[model samples]
Structure formats: structure tokens, C-alpha cells
Target: MIFIEVIKKRFGHFEGETVWQWTMINDHGMKISVLNYGAIITSIETKDKFGEYANISLGFSDMDDYLAYSPYFGATLGPVAGRITKGQFSLDGEEYQLTQNEGANHRHGGKLNFSKKLWNVSVEKELDQIVLTFEYTWADGENGYPGNINAHMTYTLNNKNEWIIDYTAHTDKPTIYNPSNHIYFNLSGKAGSTILPHQLWVNSEKFLPIDKEMLPIGEIRSVENTIFDLRAGREMMEIIKNQDELLQIAGKGLDHTFILKHENGKPDAVLFDPQSGRRLEMETEADSVLVYTSNSMAGDFEINGKTVPKYAGITLETQGLVDAINHPGFGNIVLRPEKPFKSKTAFRFAVES
Candidate 1:
């Protein structure tokens, strides 16, 4: 059975509205904490091979920390995740400009992105799993997007230790809609420790090359001879230390979106930490997965009273291709009134024994 609790009541208030947090414990003893603000996954506790439970998700213990300094920690990113060239996009022969928060480009929506908004939350038991649902409605022209979009995200923790995220959205007008969860995972369960020891395997043999600004340059290149080749499991540190130009351009680490070869049930990526013997298999239906190694953390934020330095965690963001709206060759990110949008991504946890 799954046990659910409201560990924090009125965790914070946004726009004079009360926001709350909920905790769900699965039968396997996996615990997940979520907040209404940003529909964030505050914490995820799982056992290692030694049977010791620890929080594997990088986040702050205090709500104030989340409000003051959150680098998209455990937050849901939407209307359109990733960057749009020059904060501009054309839809139906008309151009629209968005609020530029990330330099000259619009990133993860806009200046007032979904990650900073409050969501209406609900919890219910779906079979043996505890499902936490978060809903948010974006008005037309909010952040300069052209639609009144209604988004629903559900987090389900099952007995098998799988945390499944289901995302669905409907837009009244034609607009770009690519949503993703930006939860940083450190299988070592130590927030302060670097995730360099973790081994990662991505099923993709190709990744989008990005410019200095971190926006995809519209070129999908092969990962064969570069450090981007994670088709076979490789330690993150080994790949980081490689003298690859792309790695140098990306701040000496990974912050690129890999073109996922598989579309459905197949696992898109696998991450394992040898020290803790903790393993995570990511299965998603999204077209691409953004692998960010937290290279720009700056060691300024404190999580659980410990300083979180650079490379402390890795974020696997599965969503429609980055900057899809600007690249015609990229996957479709348009959501119209006649057709709703839907996507699912699952993170299954286990021990390597």
C-alpha cells in the first residue's frame, strides 16, 4: 500500500494564494515529496544496496530557499521548455515575441515561467499507487504565448518503485507546448557530492550541437567519436575530462539534448552510481532528452544545510526537441485546439546489488 501525508501545510503563498506540499510513501519504502508551487518534486528518498534510505533528489529543505534561489530545482518547465531563438517564433504566418529571460532568448517559457507559478494540486489513490496531480491554466498572451493553455501533470509512485510523470495539455489557440520536469538526480544520495562517479548510458547515437549561448544551432551530429557518445555506459568524469570541443563550449560538461532513438517503452537512458549501487532507468515517450550535469551550480545554494557545488547532480529532461518551434526539422511542438498534447516519462529506481 501507498501512504500519503501533508507534511507541510501552507508551505508558502503565491499571489496571495496558499501553496502546500505533500509526501507520498510507496510500499517499497520509496518516498516522494511534492509542492504546489511549480509542481515541484521536493525530495525523493530511496534505499541503496545497503538498505539505507537517502534523498536522491537535489533540493532545498526550506520553502524559503526554494522561493529565493531555485535554479529550476525539481520544477516543471513549460509552455515550451528550452530556448527559442531570439525570443521569437512564427506560427500561421504571424510572428510572436516572448519575454527574454535568458539573455536574448526565451527559455523555459518566459520571465514569469510556469516554474514560478502556483498550481492547483490534488492527491488520490489510483490502484496501489498514490497519484499526485497538479493543474495550471495559462491565459492567452501570458508570457507572450498565443494560447490559453490548460496543463495537467500527474506524478504516480507505484509499489515497484517507479515514479511516473504524465503530462497533458490543451490549448485554445495554436501555440507551442513542450513541457518537461527539471528534477536533478544524484544517485549517490549525497547532495554535496559531485555526480562524476555515476555511470550514464543514453540510447541515442546523435545529439544536437548547441551554440555558446546553449541554444541548439540546428545541427544534429553523430556522437560516434565525441564525448557525447554515451551509447555505452561511461563514467561522467571520464567523459567530462575528454578534450572535446563541444564539451568545452558547453562549460566542460554535458548540457545537450540527445535525439532519442526509441519512442515508447524502451528505456532512453540509464544512470548508475557504483558507490551507492543505486540505479535509475529513464523511460520516456519524448523525442529528446536533455542531459545537464549542473556545471554552473556556482556552489552558492544550500540544500539541507550543505552547499551544493557544481556537478552535484544531473538533470534528465525528456521533452519535445529543444527549440522545436524554430527548427522545422525538429519535432513538432505545436498544440492546437483540435488536438491536445500528451507525454509520459518514467523513472524507475533500483539497486544494483
Candidate 2:
């Protein structure tokens, strides 16, 4: 059976805020709670083969905790997802500068991006889903970007235990856009524990190479003979210590975009927790995925009195490359009046035993 509860609170500069949580339960008795905030998955509780129920994701208990977290866990990122080199981009023969939130690059849509904004929430209890919508008008040059844009995010969970996230957007003017949700997963449901034991596989043969600034240097490299190779499922820890470009770029872990070799819209990656006997499959229409091992996470970034550790969480983001608008070879992320924008990504959880 599924259950839902509506919550209202006075939160963080925004008054009378509302968040709806939808709980999806399978026949096996596994439960997943998805909150409207960021379309965030607050918890995933599943019974092991031994009949022990355990949560397999990380998050805080209240809205205040989420407000303070710049971590971007299970949050929808937009306008443009990932890093934009030099904190700027050029469109229509003009260069526009954005907020330098990540060193010299504009990361995850810069400071005060879409994830931080409050969304209009809609609940569908019958479908076990929540829809969040928000609008932003760039006003010629907000954040040095262009055009007025409207966006919507729909999150749904099915009887089979799949969280379907769909994103749609339209712009009245020309602008660069790349929207995605950032969901950090820890199969063991604890922080400070390494995700090394988890087995991961990505369906990709090539990946974009980054410069010292972590910007795409406009080169595509093969994953063969490199730690980036996950074509054959391998323990994450097995490749963590390996000195490879992928690990080096992320400084002790991974934050690289893997270009899917096949674009059939099926699942391109699988992450399995051997100990829990639970698995997550990611299916999306996006062309590339940013696989990030939370190596930079520290306890100092506390939420709800709980400290989260590095390597305790992982984010798999499906979208265009970090700076797709600048690179013609990459997918086009431009939204214009004549063309509407739409994207979808889904994370499905299942028990092996």
C-alpha cells in the first residue's frame, strides 16, 4: 500500500512553503518516499532476503536541512546543468558571463540556481507521483544568460518500484538550457561508509576529456584500459585507487561525463549493492551522464545535526555535456521560440533476492 502526507512550514526566506511526500510500496514491502522538494528521494526502505528493512539513501529530516545544503542531492538543476567554462558562454556571436560558483567555471547553474528556488507543488496520490513546476525569466541577461524560460519537473513512482522523472521546458527567446536532477545514492543508507563495494556498469565507449579547469577540451577519448571503463561491471573500490584521467580529474574519485554509445533511450547504467541485494537501474533520453563520486563531501556541511562523509554518496546525472552550448560536436542545448525543450530520466530500484 502507498501513503502520502502534506507538509507546510515557514522555511528559509520563503513563507508558507509546502512539500508533498509520496510513499510507494511494492508487494515485497519495500517502501520509497519521494518529497516534492527537488523531487528528492528522502528514503528507500527495503527488506533484505533475511527480512530486515534498511534505508538505502541519504538525506535530512526537514526543509531547513535541505535549505542549507549546497550539496544538490536529489535536486533538479537547470538553465544549464554541469560546468560552464570560464564562468561564461558565447551565443549568437556574443559572450555572456555567469556567476563563478565553481572556481572559474559556472557549476550546476551557478549560485542561487533553480534547485534553491521553491517550486509549485502538485500531488497525484493515485499515480504515486509529484509534479513540481517553476518559471524563470532571464530578462536579456540574468546570470549573463539569455531569454525567458519556463520549466516543469514531474516525478513518479510505479508499482514496479521505478521513479520516473520527466522534465519539460520552453523559452520565448533564444537561450542555452540543460536541465537535470542530482540524486545522491548510498546503497547502505549510511554516511562515512565507502561506496567502493558497490558494483557499477555504464554503457559507454568514449568520454569527453577535461582541461585543468574541468572544462571539456573538445576531445573524446575511449574508456578502454582506463579506470573509466565500466563496460564490464567492477567494484567501485577496485578502480578508486587507480591513477587514471577520470580519477585524477575528480581528485580521488569520478566526475566525468560518459557518452552513451547507443542512444536507444533504454537504461545505460546499473549500480548493484551486493550486500543489500538491491539494485538501481538508470534509464534516460539524455545523451550523456555525469557520474560523480562524492569525494569532496565533508562532515562540515551538516544538515539536521547529522554529518555526511565523503565517498558516502554518489550522483548519476543524465544530460548534455557540461558546456554543450560552446561545443558544437556535443548535443545542442539551445532553446528558441520555435523549438520546445523536453528531457526525461528515471531511476528504478529492485531487489535481487
Candidate 3:
């Protein structure tokens, strides 16, 4: 808990506004870069078992790249993180329609959602932690949603090598809210490297099955005998190479939500790279973890001077169920004026020998 500071560096201009990167460093020499634009995380540097540090989080260094070619990357995704069946839903007995960004579904709150907006930043440093707050407010009908919401995403980089995120929001009307950080991780630190070699473990025995459109088909099936089973920790390549029909539906990999069985704030999932001995543990207040193996990661854009192909990174999005507005018994995504939204998701990185 010795030396810790957050340094702000000028990144560049997006549109006409200047964007900056705030890099926070902790006593353990773990550093993380955050951007005011998109409220995105651009980097997370941590050590492996060999004491070598590398940035494991996927993102672009420049503002132009983030604005054009980035896939959510390390951005904060919200009002709702997953897909809405047909870009339509009914909340409070009133039907609502969201602009479709995916084929026939609404995803990540559309293209101009939280990830595209510039958020106001505030910093608070304490003896053991540095908290960065990104705030934004949207009108009631901004994205065809009902509510004026004041949302805040708080990130804390502590001496324990933990990058913790806490999401808070208050709305003036009834609205469906499910926020999640859309960060893809490649423990090897090589953008061109695939995560197929990594081992993943989820604290779930059940997963939501998806149809050909990648939307949940209203089933909470058991993962006991399926490739969705990760409770025993499975290698990514093993799961990808399986002959499961769902694999083909999701383009050869995962794009499903695993219902969490976390208890007493325990980690809901863990990912480890055996080669580097780098491990990442995640705990969240969300009901499920959206497991996306970057099934369709395009290699057109470069990162670390190399293009990362499909499965190059994996996103463990912790949030309520996808299309939760349509599935009341699955998970409640409703946010009312009387019951503001509050959620926490933490990622702890370490090296295990």
C-alpha cells in the first residue's frame, strides 16, 4: 500500500472533443489504463509467474481505432448488456421498442449506447485504493427507453491487484437496466495469441441455451452433460472443438450465459493460462455470466501490431440474463425510481505457481 497514483495522459481528439487516458498504478506494480471516452479500459498490466508484466485486457490505444474498429473491447456496456429478442419488450405494462443493432435483436443497448458516450470523470484516492468515477445522464426517450437515468461506473484499483467495478444508477421512471463491463481478456498478453489454451472454470451447472440467432430460447438447461459445463474447469480448445450443435450455431464457440451459483461473494468464474501461470478470478452481483469467446472477432484491425483472430480473447460479461425484460423469472432487470440499480463486479489478477 505504498506508492499509488493515477496519471492522466492526452490520447487524442474524437470528433471535436479531446480524449484522455487515465492510468492507475498500484503498489504491486499493477497498472490499468482508463479512458474518458466510452468510459473504456484500455489496458491492464499485471505479472505472470515469471514476474513478467503484460497488458491482458483487449483494447485500442488510439481514439480513432476505438471509435471505428473496436468491438466493445474494454468499455462499460449498459442500460442493458445483452440482446432483446426482436428489439422489442414490455415494461410496466407498456410495450417498448429499441433500435436493432444486431440482425433482428437489440444488443449492448444499440451502437450509441453507454460505450459510445463520453462520460464525466472524477477521481478519489485513499491510502489503500484509488477510485475513478465515470458519470453520465441520459434523457427519458433518448434510446427509445422510458426514464431519465443518472448512471455512474466506479472503478477501484487497489494494492491487492484487483480491478473492481461498481455500477450505480437512478432513474426517474421504470426502465430495464442491466449494465456490464464488456472487456475481453487474453492472459498471454499477445493480441495475435488465441485463448484456446487457457483453462476456464465457471461456478454454474446450468446455462441458457441460444437459438440460431444467438438469443436465449427460454431454457435454463443443465450443463452436466453438455459442453457448457465448466464447473470442473475445461480448456477453451476442448470446448471449441466439441461436436455440439450449439457450437455451430454460435459460430464454433461460446456466446451464452451461464447461470451463476456463487455464494457469500465468492468468485463466480476463474480463467487461467497454464503457460504463463496468470490467473483471473471474477465475482459479481449479477445472476449470470455472458461467456463470449469472441466467436466472430475480425482480424482486420491490429492490436500490438498484430491482428487477433477469432477466440483471440474471451469476454466474461457478468450481468442479468439476456433479454431479461422478457424473462421475468430468469432475472429482474427492472430499475424504478424507488429502486435504483446497484451492482458490483470485481476482477482479481494473480500468478499461481
Model 1: lDDT of residue 86:
89
Model 3, 1-353: lDDT tens digits are: 43999899899887788898999999888999999888899999998899988999898877889877858999888788889988899876799988888887898888689988889999998888899999999778877778999998899999988999999999999988898989999999876889999999999989988899898889889998888989889999999999899888999999999999987765899999999999999999889999999999878988979887889899999999899788756878989999988889989998988
Rank candidates by TM-score, best first: 3, 1, 2
Better of 2 and 3 by lDDT: 3
Cα-based TM-score, every candidate: 0.97, 0.88, 0.98
User: What tens digits encode model 1's per-residue C-alpha lDDT throughout 1-353?
Assistant: 53543344557777788878888887777899888889888899999999999999998767778878858989999888989998999999999999898889899988678899998888887656888888999999998999899999999988889999999999889999999999999999986899999999999989999999999988889999777889888999997898787788888899999998994665899999999999999999899999999988888878877898889999999999999888868979999999999999999999998
Misplaced by over 4 Å in model 1 are 1-8, 263-265
- In model 3, residue pairs whose N, Cα or C atoms come closer than 3 Å (at least 3 residues apart or on different chains), thus clashing, are none
Candidate 2 lDDT over 136-182, as tens digits, reads 44355667667777777776655566777777887777888898877
How large is the C-alpha RMSD of every model relative to the true structure? 1.5, 2.9, 1.2
Clashing residue pairs in candidate 2, if any?
A: none
Between 2 and 3, whose TM-score is larger? 3
C-alpha lDDT of residue 56 in model 3? 95
